[model samples]
Each structure stands twice: as C-alpha cells, then as structure tokens.
Target: MKPLVAIVGRPNVGKSTFFNRMIGERVAIVEDMPGTTRDRLYGDTDWNGREFTLIDTGGLELGSGIPVGQVGLTGQPGDLMDHVMSQAQLAIEEADVIIFMVDARSGITAADDEVADLLRRSTKPVVVAANKADNAERRLDVVEFYGLGLGEPTDISSIQGTGTGDLLDRIVEALPPASEMEEEEDENIPRIAIVGRPNVGKSSLLNAVLGFKRSIVSNVPGTTRDAIDTEVEFGEQKIKLIDTAGIRRRGRIGVGVEKYSVLRSTRAIERCDVALLLIDASEGLAAQDTHIAGIIHEMGKGVIVIVNKWDIAQEQIRAEREGIYPDPDDEIQSAESYRKALMGALKFIPYAPIIFASAKTGYHIKSILETALKISDMRYLRVPTSRLNEVVQEAVRRHHPAAVTAMKPLRVYYATQTRVNPPTFVFFVNDPRSVHFSYERYLENRLREAFSFYGTGIRIFFRARSSKEER
Candidate 1:
C-alpha cells in the first residue's frame, strides 16, 4: 500500500487548492465558501517516482460541536461541523502522515490549536504547512505556527504552487520506505462498490445482501459518510464489498462534509472491479443517477443497475383491488415502463443488466450476487486468437469499411485479443486512421454477437500494419 497523506485544516484554509496542486488537476471542487468540503477526498500524486495517496479532508472545528443554522455559501443552513470532524478523524486514523494546513493570514487560532492537540495524540508523523504565504511579507506569518509544536512550518501558496516541492520532500522523508510500505496482495478477490445518492437505500441494500447489519442503515440522509469495506465469502468465492456515501449533484453538494462524501464515493468507484449502482425505485430515474452511471462507465467497470425499493414501487401501482396481490399484467406494465425510462436515461451503458429488488422484503436480493458473478466472469473472459480473427473477418466481410477519401476503402489485416478484464482487442489494419467510430462500434457488436461479453465493457484498438509486416 502507498503511504496515505491526509491534508487537514480549518474551513477555507486552501486544503482543496493544495490537493488540486499536488494532483496536477482540479479534482476537488474549490470555492470561496467556508466548509465547502465535507468528506475525505482522495487523490494520487508522485514526486521523484515516490507515489502516495493524498486525502483532502473537511475543515476541522474545535469547540463548536456542530454548525447549526449558520448560513453557508449556498444560503443553506450549515450543520456539517460534526460530520466534518468525524470524517477528519477517520482520515487521521487511516493516514500514515498528516499535512496540517493553517491559514498564514489568520495567524494561530483556537481551531488550529485544537487540531494540533488532536494530532499530537496520534503516533503518525505530522507536517505543518502555512498556506497562503504567497509573498515575502506573508512568508513571515509561518513563525506564528511554530507554537503548535509539530515542527518548523513549511511556507507555501496552494494557488501559486510555491514551496510545494519542499513540502513534498518533507512528506517523502517522513514516510516509510517503499519496500516496507508494500501491503499483502488481494488482487484475486473481486471488489464491488455499492454507490448511489443519499437515502437511496445503499446501506440497506448492503445489509440485505450480506444478510446482516454490516453498515449503519438509517432513514436519515448522509448516514454513512465514509467508504466502509467488508470482505465476505459467498458460494466459495471471497469478494470485497465497499459501501460508499451518497453522491448528490454538484449543485446540491452542500459545502463541507458532503463534498468529501462525493469524492470518497468516486474513489470507491475507481478502486472497484465491479460497481452495483443502486437507484431508488420509488424516486425513479433522476439526473444524479444518470451522472453516477456515467462515472461507472467512464471507469470501465462491470456494472449492475439495481433498482431498490421495489416493494414501495409496487405499492404505487394502481391495480384491481381484488386481493392483496396485484394483477400480473399491471406488474409487467410497470416493470416495462421503468425499464424503458431507465434505458432511455442510461443509453450509454446499455450493456449494464438491470435487476429490481427490495431490501425490505428480501425480494430478488440474491440475484445480485448471481449477476455480479456473471459480470465478473465476463470481465475476465478471453477470446482465442483464432476465434477473434474469425469473428473480425466475418464482420468485415458483412459490411466493408467506407472509403476515408474517395476510393481508398479501409482494410482489416488481422485482429488479436490484447487483454481481458474489460477485454481489449487490437486490430492490425491497412490504415488505423481510416477506422471510423461507427465502424469500431460495428466491429464491437459483431464480436459481442460471437462472444457473450455481457455486463462487461470492451475496447477495440486499431493499429496500422506496415507493408513489410504484411509481406
């Protein structure tokens, strides 16, 4: 395992800015508002070939237990202090080194002092960063943090990217050597991340699937703020399950802990081999659901669309009141309507298989495991080279590629399976540039027809075969 470096500081102290700088991309949403980040956001960075995982945590508050009725940047009530503190504490627990950031302009405050006190209790190495030290005048502000008793504070500007190299040097020195940091391998186990918006029955689905209360399930939104991982054995297969926080739309992502929740949920998606994207059946398809599905697709993970709260959806169907059961046709009609709406919204992920389940009544919950296993198998499925070339030849013969210019028709020389786990195939052709997107889709459809790669993503790569190689 790479060393975990966590950035912790007060609200609006430029933790997100620092994270974005280190990662060389604007991942964490940065805003002028205080408490803009809520959960533990993670990113990976390497300097001088020394790679480490960085976590951006919400601002730490000291005395005030919670932010009650305080207006935030979005004009909503700020009640995330407790959640922020909890998430920060969790980050600290998981971190190998802590980068405690402080505002250079504000000088030392009670919150910084409190956070310093909290860090001193942990055995993890702590590095103090005095951010916003953009100029010579502001650089002198680093002296104020010397009283925190961690060490000489590193002065830097997150926005301007100054002094970050020295800070990273300090972190690499404080971290354990890479040889000692390597963790035992568990790559064979299939990891699944359960993700969705808040109060969408994510935790309930987890509990029902595991047949126990592995995760905290409550009616309240944002109950599970951290990505909790559990390993279980079912049908002689050991699989890792990650239950993540609900992901809301960017506009609805309230400043503070909730933002971190979204980041962690995204990280979970990145780490998983398969993602069980849960949607609320009662709520139907929403924009956020579509966005979440896009994330899974972008990650190229095997996915299963789980429609939770099927019991509640059945209650809404207006069927003949002859008995407690509904008419079979009504159920079929409702299912078809839902399938159409979902298929339309998630046309990009047409390969994802859908299952309607109810965690409350254990309805079709076991099928999730069955489908997930099939998807996992499909992800690792490899097609023989002879069989792959045969399929490609047949596809090309059926519909010749349209000419790129006027009379120069594209030619497929040969094809081979390059890799598996979202199986990738490489095709050696006359001119790789002439392979249009539609032609690529046509080839993919033909390959899928010949091979059952259901519930798994596949990639087709076109490479130019030189004349000498053709000879």
Candidate 2:
C-alpha cells in the first residue's frame, strides 16, 4: 500500500495550491476565495524514490461559529468544541503524515493556533509549510509561525513552483519504505487490466468474476476515480485484476480530479501484462476505443478486445433471424464483414483476440479469463532457430522482397529469437533495406501459422550481415 499524506489547515491557507504543486499537476482547484474546496481531492505524488498518495481536504475550524439564536446554541460548550475537534481528529487518524499549511503573509490566526494545539496531542508526524512566501519580505514573515510549536516552517510559493522539491524531500523522509508496507504477492501471477472509456461495465465485470461486490457499480460514468487492484485465483492461475478509472481524450479532460484520473489510467496500462480493451457491444466501437488501442500497441503489451453487453447483441440477432435472410454463404460473408469492421476499429492491435460477453450475466466471462492467461503465455514464447528459418524461407518463396541496388539476391542469412514477452526476432540479412513491410508481414503470418502464437503480437528487426573480415 502506498503511504497516505493529508494536507490540513484553516480556510484560505493555500492547501489546495500546495496539493497541486506537490503532485506535479493541477489536480486541485486553487481559488483565492475561502471555502472553495468542499470535497476531498486525492492524487499520487512521488518524492525522491518513494511514492505516496496525497489527500487534500477543506479547511477546518474549531467551531461552527453559530449564533446563540441560530440553532439554539448555548455558549462555547465542550460539546460544540468536540464536533469541530472530530473533523480535525478524523483527518489526523487517517493520515500517515500531515502537512499543516499556513499563510506567511497573513501570519498565524486564532484558528491556526487552535488547530495546532489539537495536532500537538496526536502522534502523527507533521510538517508546517508557510505558503505565499514569494519574496524576501514574506520569507522573513515565516519566522512568526515558529510560535505555533510545529517546528520551523518550510517556506514555499506553490503557485510559482518554488521550494517544493526541498519540501518533498522532507515529506519523503517522513514516509516509511515500501518493504515495511507488507504488500501481498503471488508467484507468476498474470496482471490483467480492464481498460475502456467511461461506464463500459469494467467494474461490473470485476464484480461478476469475484462473485461478490468487490467494486462499487453504478450507471454513472467515471464513477471510479482510482485504480483499484484485487487478486483472485482462477483455475490453477492467480490473477491480479486492476480496475482503473474511465479514460477520456486528452482535450476533453477537464481540470482538477478528472484530469488526475486519466494520468492514473495511463500508468496502470504501462504496468500490466495483458490489457483487456472493453467496448460496449450495444454502442459498438468509437474513436476513443481506437485511441486506447493505439496506446496499448505502442506499449508492446498483449491485448484482448472484450465486447461487453453480449446479451443485448444476442437479442438483436434473434430478432433479425426472423426476417428473410440471404443464402448461407451470404450470411457467413456478413458475419465476416461485421468481424472485419470491429477489427478495423482496433487495427493497431491486429493480433488481439476479440471475445463477446456480458459482464452483467457472467456470459463467456470464464472464457475471457482463460484467453487472457493464454495470451500472456504466448507473449513469452520463444521460437527455435530451425523453425524460425523454415517460416522465413516459406515467406520469401510466397512474396520475395525487392533486392537493394548493387546487392546480389538479397538473402537472409539467419533468423533467431532474441527475446520473449512480446517475442522479438532478429534477422541477419545481406541487405536490410530490401525487406519491405509487406514481406515482413508475410513472414510474421507464416511464423504464426507454423507456431500457434495467437493472441500475441510479434516484432521483427533486420540487421545487415557483417563483412567476412569483421566476422
């Protein structure tokens, strides 16, 4: 588990600005007006080599300041103070580390001193950041905050990006290392990531597989704001499924927490073994779906296309069967046409296996898990040199590559598998430029046909043969 750091202080003390600066992005809304931040904004921040989640909360006050006639409130009773104490008390309990922010220009207020006294009783580590110290005059004003009894203040101008690195180093020093966190692990577990646009039944799929409510499911879009990871054993294999927030196009991503969600989803894709690209079968494919497939291809990870809401598709097919249909071969052609259309939407990920299922009813859900494991296994497959050469020869015979100028019969001297996990092959050729994309695709197809490397993408590299003296 990542360390949790909570930023707490009185209103208008620049807590949100400090939060946005710490995460290296504009995750929190920073407004000059007080009471602007009402909800909690969460984001990930890495300091030095340690990563921690930062939670920004609204400003706290010791009391509601309700008039005596307003809510029949008496004087400053202990009960009224207890209510305000509970709010700050809750933040201290949840935080692994606390950052008490105060405005250097404004100096310390009665509210700031009240909260300081409360935090002094808690054992949580606290760092006091003096915000808006943009000039030497303001820097000198930070000295007055030492009386709050939270140690010397670390001055920062969050809006101008000043002094944050030094503050981060101090924050990292307060956090515990990863080894002390006791993260659970299983051997050779396949890490599967369910990724798609907003409200595409990703959480529903996770709930169906777990046979319980592992994640909160709702009809609302972008309900999931963080990447929630859970593990389960399917058959003999242990799988770690990471359900990430819905990803939006870069231009459409609004500022604040929504933008941070997109960043988290991108990070999740980079760390997974196989990405299950979920698409709504009812809505078919969209431009955003194609964009996501492009990211997966560029990452060189294995992919599986899951067309969810299959129950709805089957109902539509049943209604269509009642009408006058064409010949059997025409029907087969139509099926192939529809398949090609879906494949065209994900053209960048041509090797991915597409499965139709309904995450709601658990329809074909088992097969989806099985396919992910098989694809992960295939991604790590290594081909023998003798078999690789045979496939190369067959590919050359079918569609020979054009010869480079001044080179005699551009020959491929040998082919060998250089690496697995997205299985890369290197071809030592007499003329590397002679190998065209068409011939390369032909060679890949032949290799796939010879060796059942389905559901896995292959990469090929061509290098010119060394001269006789150099060899």
Q: Which one is best on lDDT?
A: 1
lDDT of 1 by residue, 286-363 (tens): 889999999888777899999999888888654335346766787888888899889888988888899999988889
RMSD of 1: 4.6
lDDT of 2 by residue, 324-431 (tens): 544658634644666689887676566788887899989889999999999889888888889888878877777777765665666777789999878899988887
Error of 2 at 225 (Å): 5.8
* Alpha-carbon lDDT, every model: 0.82, 0.78
| Candidate 1 residue-pair clash tally | 8
TM-score of 1: 0.80
Worst 10 residues of 1 by lDDT: 61-70
Poorly placed runs, candidate 1 (over 4 Å): 1-4, 11-13, 25-44, 50-90, 94-96, 104-107, 136-144, 173-188, 254-257, 319-326, 397-415, 427-439, 460-471
Pairs that collide in candidate 1 are 1-183, 35-256, 36-256, 37-256, 38-256, 38-257, 39-257, 39-260
CA RMSD, predictions in order: 4.6, 8.6
